[model samples]
Target chain A: MSELTPLNAIGEFALINRLQAGLTLRQPGSVLGIGDDAAIIRPTAGTELVMTTDLLVEGIHFDLSFCPLRHLGYKAVAVNVSDVAAMNALPTQLVVALSVGPRFTVEAVEELYAGLRLACEAYNVDLVGGDTTASRGGLTLAITVLGEAPTGKAVRRSGGKPTDLLCVSGDLGGAFLGLQVLEREKQAFMADPETQPELANYEYVVQRQLRPEARLDIVHELRELGVHPTSMIDVSDGLASEVLHLCAASGTGARVFSEFLPLANPTLEAAAEFNLDPITCALNGGEDYELLFTVPVTDHEKIKNHPDITILGHLTGKEEGTNLITKAGQPVPLKAQGWTSF
Target chain B: MSELTPLNAIGEFALINRLQAGLTLRQPGSVLGIGDDAAIIRPTAGTELVMTTDLLVEGIHFDLSFCPLRHLGYKAVAVNVSDVAAMNALPTQLVVALSVGPRFTVEAVEELYAGLRLACEAYNVDLVGGDTTASRGGLTLAITVLGEAPTGKAVRRSGGKPTDLLCVSGDLGGAFLGLQVLEREKQAFMADPETQPELANYEYVVQRQLRPEARLDIVHELRELGVHPTSMIDVSDGLASEVLHLCAASGTGARVFSEFLPLANPTLEAAAEFNLDPITCALNGGEDYELLFTVPVTDHEKIKNHPDITILGHLTGKEEGTNLITKAGQPVPLKAQGWTSF
Candidate 1:
């Protein structure tokens, strides 16, 4: 949307061109790219396609007050990539359906596309085709990411063994705490029109909210480590909630020590400053965008020495039930208080 | 939306569960459906897949004043299927990501799903996966449909020939006029709330808006008749605009007789009632969801007697340019003023 003069960034047809431009296909199977009634991609051989979709609403999933448009676009593609990643596959293409209110300028739309293009480059994805429409209300983005994995190789949440080690990549709760800090700062600004957000002390937490990266790098790293998780799900809804999904799908229980939870220094500091329980935030606050997977014990040694991976717990017998063990060895039931938009 | 009392629908989780429960996936490739991060489709034969996405925003693409939740859901699926149909492929699966506000309820979401499931059933498509989230504003729907065609056989809009006979299936502008009448009635109702809608006269046009069907049946029939369109595009954006696309993509021009443009009885009546030109509506107004294609003239004889197919004109050399020749033999320059939400 960068321009020298006053402009309406999202003049219906221009958005379609922006999305289709700069995307080059590597395969002949891409029968079509853009500017048509429908996009056509030849199905791959020896593999059935994996598909997933996500909708990100403006005021609900993000706020322009703190969340930059570029990062939001990146996160938008990243989360969809995470789904493809969670399927233990490599994403090859994407279709974006964008709806925006007239308030958005072409420059704003370009900024969003800049972030989206960045993700497409890093992930080696082609922006094939999509519909761009006007919204009567907010800016809404709906992305459908297409991925491919060898037939029968997609890791499902139901395949974990009772003895599998529960592991996570990167940290948890940063995005949640980041949201908290952003909300607090916005409130401060609203109370005093002249006041600016004072966020030097909470930079990391703020970054976590404004810009979140999916753990696709971990996906590649794990591929190099020669490990395929028996049961995998991303930390999208919150740790406890995702754990419940893995447990329910695998028909097992989880036992983890509270001390083993990973929390960044900034996250812990910000949580305490806000009078929040860091442990609870890590447990129930969502948007961590990390990888939560269960691997057979045999595969543990491969990742155990890795710096970013965290071995939080082990899959448990059903009779033991889904529980959280304290630092002092006490047991408590685990519950899923995931972020509910409705 | 059907519920007399909406207060009980506040908790969104229950509604999600209810919608998820009644639906079933019968696809052989579907390893899982609807309950996880993503659905896995074990593609057979590692074939080339066709993927397309369409976005529909409330107020822009639809009006709640006339479009029911059920028909909105049906139309959403239908339009996506129309894209797949344009490819001359068989639809196998779909993923729908939906955003709605609190005004919607458990039963309301179910009504929408019921309509979607009906389209899926009729079209032999499986509902593989989707994202359901809350919207801060009006409802938004993004549906991505996956289709399958034999390797090297998918049709595209860029393959038209200069001498190809331009053909169309069914009629046009019913949906457009349908929208016009709906908007008119909505205004009338705003002027006097005591009046019931005078909609019976516009029933067919209204149905075109409410329950537009994809031309998948025509796709099958074309195959049975041993016809492969030299070029094809769906008539979602109206006859003239689609003709322009077919010509532009093929580096050719099209000359169509406005006399040959098909119109449903209700569309003509509504146009007359509104003091509007039916031919203009058929030319520029969109959302028809019919098949518009160009077949080699050699193959036209084969389809000359086919009930649903109507030969309109022929593709011409680019030098001749795109034109709409009226019954009196006057050449009119064609401009594609398809519906623009912006």
Candidate 2:
């Protein structure tokens, strides 16, 4: 390890100076950035603003023993951005508030900011302003993202109508399986200090868990194809829970076909190794950061052949109830069973 | 104590349901509120958005021993709203994210939100969206405020000129003294649990510490009087510190007259009771949430005799340095002993 300065050594002002030195504003609406009582932005004319905030607690949301600081920072920003994309909006700015304990060094904070900057660069978003303070417990990250969409264009989870085709972006269960592998390796390392855990073969699943990407590309593609989703949500708390959210908000029921659920090969292999069912993981696993939406059946032609898109099922009347049709031709009531910290 | 529901008993979804039921939409721009992936708002045309975020950590920022949960919630929102007021903006919406430990009851969370809702209603700001989850340690609150100001009309800390008149609204040092009283009472209570704390004598100061109001009324008064501040900041970290911030940002210096400083009777009495200098408390104490600003010398006549406004001194060249002019005709360089979490 390199010699690094602890946060207290340089004090809060110096730390803020070091962090602000590398920021470059890329958003035209960002009239004024940091170094003020507040940030100033000019929302684009004729557009509406979309805002979302998410809090990630240390022990509850992640374990530092397995989660890298940089990846944790990236994931924090990505999850909030995912929420914006779920509204069919383009992310523009982010305000990140972080609290760290005494154990966190300035270099560790820099590594975390590096990941934040990387995400900003990838998503074309600007870091506007935030508050940084010392924590009494473990590290906590609270990120708020600002996005924009044309008036009347932003989607909502309550807009879905019966018979609308349900679709999902990317694959699921990879992140959950990835977490299982990391937990297993951590337990092994804890039990025997001399053991060197081999993880080369589990790279794909592990990376999914460490660094999930937001599906903003799908939002752009839908706009380009002139196909607007009637309703949308991000798959953060598992597909089953998110589907239930959509159903509850839209006052409709959903029929998700188990056969059409997307599952990557690495996820399946990892689930098997853990003696867990792959389908269950795909259905109930969380933190995939995928976009789930419903579009009119007539618009399916525009999205059907897309490589990253999968048609899960369609919306149904509220009387039908939300269910998952298994491959064995049995209907099971969809239970959320989302990851709950309480 | 009354019977209360544990957080786990009702679960996350049920808690959300209970909280959302009480929220009503007051902001016309709020196209979509909670129950969606993100909140949507349309800022009035040709207005710039002012954004600010603050994080308050348990044990670090406040002590639950004396700090009521409702007051903590109100203070969290007020502090951020104070930032918006410093920018000469009207607050419109807020996003509050909270993390609570398992020990917190559903009733406790509702008490916190009741305070939040009260603040929102008082400021006419909508509670648009947020995320709530479990924490490993104590309660944490992260609040982000969104406000609007006409383009090019928002005040900034860097707009002061050499001849600008330095001014502050309301009195100072009350909150700091209030905190001192609370700490002393808490120590006494800890020494003997049977002792009933007497707070009637310290009502004014105690209230200041528990519920500091954002000076939005001052922002409105300034606008109505046709006096646009050249530079502004909220007194969150002492008068001397905030003066230095304005000076550093504006590339100027300031001369504050100690005799002209505003000190409430309660603040002076409290400081004397602790055997601390009243002047020092007025200068170095924080969390007053008062507006400290500068205006052109030509506009002094318009604000000179305002009941709540005090003309502290005037800005000076950087070479002159920031100083506090004492009643004995002595000039002392101002020091920024602002609160530091680290």
Candidate 3:
């Protein structure tokens, strides 16, 4: 193990805060989120309920050598929230079950809760009941989030149409670029104990890696724009992976020109610093937590000039194929490596 | 590490099945309790919801050197359900998260889930959704459960009155004694690997430890009889500890005659064989999963003849103090050593 990547490292709570920061909550139904005994949700009569849960373990979903505990805590909730958001439902309550090794303490727990609370507040969620126990090894966080949509509006990954225009919100590849910077800094810090990490200049890239926000804003914006996605998913396992997911579920294919890919300024700067192509980072980077969906072409003119939203591509025949066009005009196939936790 | 205890050991799914084979589901709302993507639940409207969670980690909560995973899994959910039952509520849903090390296989996860699912079915709860992740070390199981009661009928720990008749459901000390049998068997097996774990003779005691059930039946009976508990709690952290919780929360003290302590016939047999006192086991051993509570004096007639219910004590003014009566007619102070996980 690298000296900088200390083994059996990380107190439980510190890892939590690294994952929760700078998010927004725009739902009125979210009465509570992230830090409490149990979340209390108030759903109108005739409304149904949906709940989902997920768990993340160190040495599995992340390497503390590169991942921070605060970010871990934030990601724990974010991933579950993403699942709820994928259902196209508004989230209201979350319960966390955390198991920490002796490597944790009161301070560490507070840090984790701080990040959890931040995420809950951003998503207009309430942190309800949870479990806390001591683990014999690396940190493990299990979160169950509760969501409520109107009586019959809970969207599934299986809901899409043949002519839906595949749309994506915000930019991708920024988080992947951010990870590159962190990994390099970690390597430099490991090479010499006295070396100071020069991360000040890569603020945006670092934020992408350390604190990726959930795309609830798009969920809300679409509702207000009166444009509902035929189907949707958040990019956690990578963009290509998510695209295939929408296609496979909707039984359709899609085509996108690489020139239209969204790239944050920081992404280009960071990729340049590392002497790497920015498009690759944008295409395959995971943890962006951005929304990927399909809307009818009629909705295209409705959001064509929108600043953050992008018309990445459009759905097609199942046999037509899912491919990305290069700016150099070469066609490239899209494949999802899928996140390997094993 | 006891040879029989299976130190750092996780059972394959088959063994887990064998372990859960002994318990039977006893509730009607237990739909799709254990083996599915997520447990499904159905609760009638106008019911108040009560939820609680508990997490158990190896080394911290149990020493596999002595504790078994099958038992641990069952205990984890049973204890939390007991909390809901203590409030005179019916458990409805459960979500389980487990983190495993590389030494385990899919079979092990299945076994753990089997135990968890068994408890859910036994208590009429749906499995709902949960997370499964990899752990860097020993087994970690975290479970959160949801329960329900009539909007205004859910009993709380703070409802006892000065003259309430304190009661306990079922015999105590068997589960505690069962734990002792397991510990002793572990020691004996460590001395001789060929031992078949002579627990057949101590079936009652061992079952209490390995497959304890929540007293949900008592809660239902009370409702049917039109009797409501003034205050309640499960006998999880020892009877003494639970009595104190009731007293402190109800703003009163308890006075009980030692002769009124209830112990199973099997518990007495095992106590004699182990050279132990059954009353001590009843008083201090945790994990009984039985309800310890108080009812208004006028309602005593409602449950007095109830087969499974036992009258153990009564509530009094703070000036009376919390006391335990000895078989010898002497008052004794109560001591609680809650399942020490620290």
Candidate 4:
């Protein structure tokens, strides 16, 4: 790293000028981007826009001790993009408002923005505009993402029907297990300054925690497969929680089978190492950033052999209630024990 | 306030449910609103959308000792709406992200949302979606406003040409003056706990600081009068700073007359009380949220007699430089002494 430039030395306007250097609007609808009072976007003639916002506050959402600024920045963008994917929309533009404490330097802020830029490129979204201000506490990021979907094509959380197959992309529980590993390492370091983290065996789980990617690929693939989800939501608050959300919004019930949960080898091993039940971890752990949706029973054939997706359950009549069927054939009510900032 | 219920007691989801109560989508284009992964908006035909974001951090952009949460919320929306108005658009929707410390009660958060809802109703904008989370510091607000404008009617900051008349809506400097009064009262109260603030005589200026409205009405009036501004910007960072921005963006220069600045009676009186030059305050004090623009000389006849509009000066060649012409006929180079969070 070069010598750090104090944020105040260059002032807000100069820092903004430096941050915006070499930036280009890649989205065709982005008529005007940064350096204006507001960004202008020419909406596609037959498209509806989806908007979402997420806030990440230091000491609440992430710890500076282990969470690198760059990865945090990427996660901030990916989370909002995940919401857009849940709506079956393709992200187009984003505006980030960042508040940094006095301890931050201009170079440090640049590194954060660099990660944001990388995610924007990966998601094919344009960095339209943003606000930068000073915070009395630690770093805070508020990101708002705008995505576009063809007229009447965006999915909603309230459109599910009885017997619809509830499916989820990728595996779950890895991110939460990964956080456990990181927490253990941090504790070891605090107990002895010379302690080093042994993460070689937990690489996959660690990556899931530190740099989760939005499951936008599934959205595109589903479109190509001609399988429109009846109801959809991102797995931001664990599978059990999101399943409940889908059921509540759709005014239906669900039956999730413990034996059918898609669990990665890494996540299973980490859960065993932590002496935690793999099924419980899969059901209640959060932050996987995977897409969860329900499709008509007839559409299941198209996605049955899809390697990255899993059929976890099916929607049922509202009177049936939401439950998880165990291997022993016992039905236990599902609960949402997802992460809560409060 | 009712019995102070702690934020954690209700949990994040319940808190969200409480906050979103009775929030109806008034905009015809708002297809979906809160309680979903993302909000959906169907853009009006042949219109472009404008977007902007602003962040307000406690102890940096505001002092809660003299600022109410409701007023702070209103100001946050107004500031972002001001940016949209600068683009000559009508605001359509808004998304707010709030982070509150443990000290904030559920009732307090409700108060803040009340103000936000009031602003949404006032602007005829929909409260689409938002994220609420815990903060380690005081309250922080990040607001993003979305507005709509006709296909090619949205104004930009780079259209000013030499000799275009510089125009501004309403008076300036009252917000800054109001802040000074508040700070003074806070100090006196700190020295003597029972000392009451002497704000009766400074009600107008005090209100300016506490709750400044965005000049969207002027944008509508300009359109109705058929006077299209060649270039426009909101007077957020004072008249001089915005003039410099217009000049820099348009590759022109400007000459502002000291005597032509519109000053409200309360602002003038407050300036005298603080022993600050009225011209200096109007040229440098920020947060007025008024519109600053330039129009072709031919359109001057349309707005010349408008009660709220004032013609300050005119654009000049780049070589002439941006200057404030004093009543004594001396040209003093303009400088941007706007607020800097750093």
Poorest stretch of ten by lDDT in candidate 1 chain A:
A1-10
lDDT of 2 by residue, A197-284 (tens): 7688899888888999999999999989999999999998899999999999999999999999999998888888899998888778
Ordered by DockQ, highest first, the candidates read 4, 2, 1, 3
Winner of 1 and 3 under lDDT: 1
Model 4 bad stretches (over 4 Å): none
Please, what are the lDDT tens digits per residue for candidate 4 over residues A294-319?
99999978999999999988999999
- The candidate that wins on lDDT is 4
The better candidate by lDDT, 2 or 3, is: 2
Per-residue lDDT for B203-255 in model 3, tens only? 89787876778888888888889888888888876788788878877889888
Using DockQ as the yardstick, the better of models 3 and 4 is: 4
Per-residue error (Å), model 1, residue A246: 1.0
Per-candidate clashes, comma-separated: 7, 0, 27, 0
| Error at A72, model 2, angstroms | 0.7
What interface root-mean-square deviation (Å) does model 1 yield?
2.1
For model 3, state the Cα shift of residue A163 in Å: 1.3
Ranking 1 against 2 by DockQ, winner: 2
True contacts kept of each: 0.77, 0.88, 0.38, 0.92
Model 4 chain B: lowest-lDDT 10 consecutive positions? B1-10
Q: iRMS of every model, one decimal? A: 2.1, 0.6, 5.6, 0.5
Write the residue-wise lDDT of candidate 4 on B196-250 in tens digits: 8899999999999999999999999998999999999998888889999999999
